[model samples]
Target: MQLTQSSSVEIPMNDAKEVDSVTLEPVDSQSGMDGGLKAWLTVVGGWIAGFCTFGAANSFGVYQALYTLEGTSSASNISWIGSLQLCLIFAMGILTGKLFDAGYFHHMQIAGMLLYVFSHFLLSP
Candidate 1:
């Protein structure tokens, strides 16, 4: 005669296996409209400013050639002018970034705008 024993174990259902109704947050209809307007305004403003400042700088090659002609200025000396300008522009970016990180964007932007206007006026000669 032989005796045999059987063991029974209960398995629990996985939490993910249970199907429950999901509720989604409602979307705001005006959200897209508001964001689009703001984005477009920023893009337009940037384009205007870029064209006025950077676009003007791109025309520097024409001016440099004229300045480097005989009786005006030596090419070697005139080349330094552009180098100094680029150096100053890049250096100012460092300071501006620091100021912006400190939440001084408005002041920095105002100062930059004023400086840009003043420089252009002074160089208008």
Candidate 2:
């Protein structure tokens, strides 16, 4: 049974054949990888995202400090906010990358934008 994105893939590490089943065999790399407007835009978008995510990750220290100063909670409880942010970023990366591979780019992109805006809206309080 071929496992696809729509179908749950149960990969057993002990089974080499199952691992091989998941590998994407390369085909016509030039058709996709050759430089073009879309390729360059993707590179630019990736660079922007890399810089922004790095900045956001680093900004957790700032948030930690702010929370500490605000006296909203103890250091221990406040730390969970940053930890949750980091965890969600990693988890979403895994989910959304798979979605992108499965041709859900537009839906994921819009949902991401809405979620980002909603987060900011919630934080504004």
Candidate 3:
């Protein structure tokens, strides 16, 4: 009996086609208003406004002491006023976060600053 074995041969290519180079277009500078100096300024302004207005709550201790000494209102009643102010300040974060995500942070920030200034000006009397 005779057995034959066959070997497979591999073929090699001598020349290959070169692919064309790709060209990319430059990005426009003013694509959207979401990011830039204005946006950063808005964020900074919002933080300042929030701290100036809501942060006043921390002075409750001074007001409480004065109110107690004046004897016009009970300490318990004044405490509730401070608590309510604190609750509102914290709750406003929810709305501010949503508005900021919606790209309306600048508008909201400006409005908030105006309101803060106006409230103080009008309430000063």
Question: By TM-score, how accurate is candidate 3?
Answer: 0.52
Instruction: Give the lowest summed-lDDT range of ten residues in model 2.
Output: 18-27
Which order, best to worst by lDDT? 2, 3, 1
Q: What is the TM-score of each candidate against the true structure?
A: 0.61, 0.65, 0.52
lDDT of the candidates, in the order given: 0.70, 0.75, 0.72
What is the per-residue lDDT of model 1 for residues 1-125, given as tens digits with 9 covering 90 to 100? 23223333334445756754443344555564556777889889879966876666666666678777644778878778777776776688788788889999789779878998888787653
Task: Flag clash pairs in model 2.
Answer: none
lDDT of 3 at 83: 94
Please report the candidate that would top lDDT against the real structure: 2
Off by over 4 Å in 3: 1-54, 121-125
Better candidate by TM-score, 2 or 3: 2
Q: How big is the positional error of residue 108 in model 2, measured in Å on the Cα after superposition? A: 0.8
Candidate 2, residues 19-63, lDDT tens digits: the string is: 544534444545675677988999999898778776777687777
lDDT of 3 by residue, 20-119 (tens): 4433344454675578898999799769866787578787778788878989889999799789878988898899888989999679868977876786
Q: Which candidate gets the maximum TM-score versus the true structure? A: 2
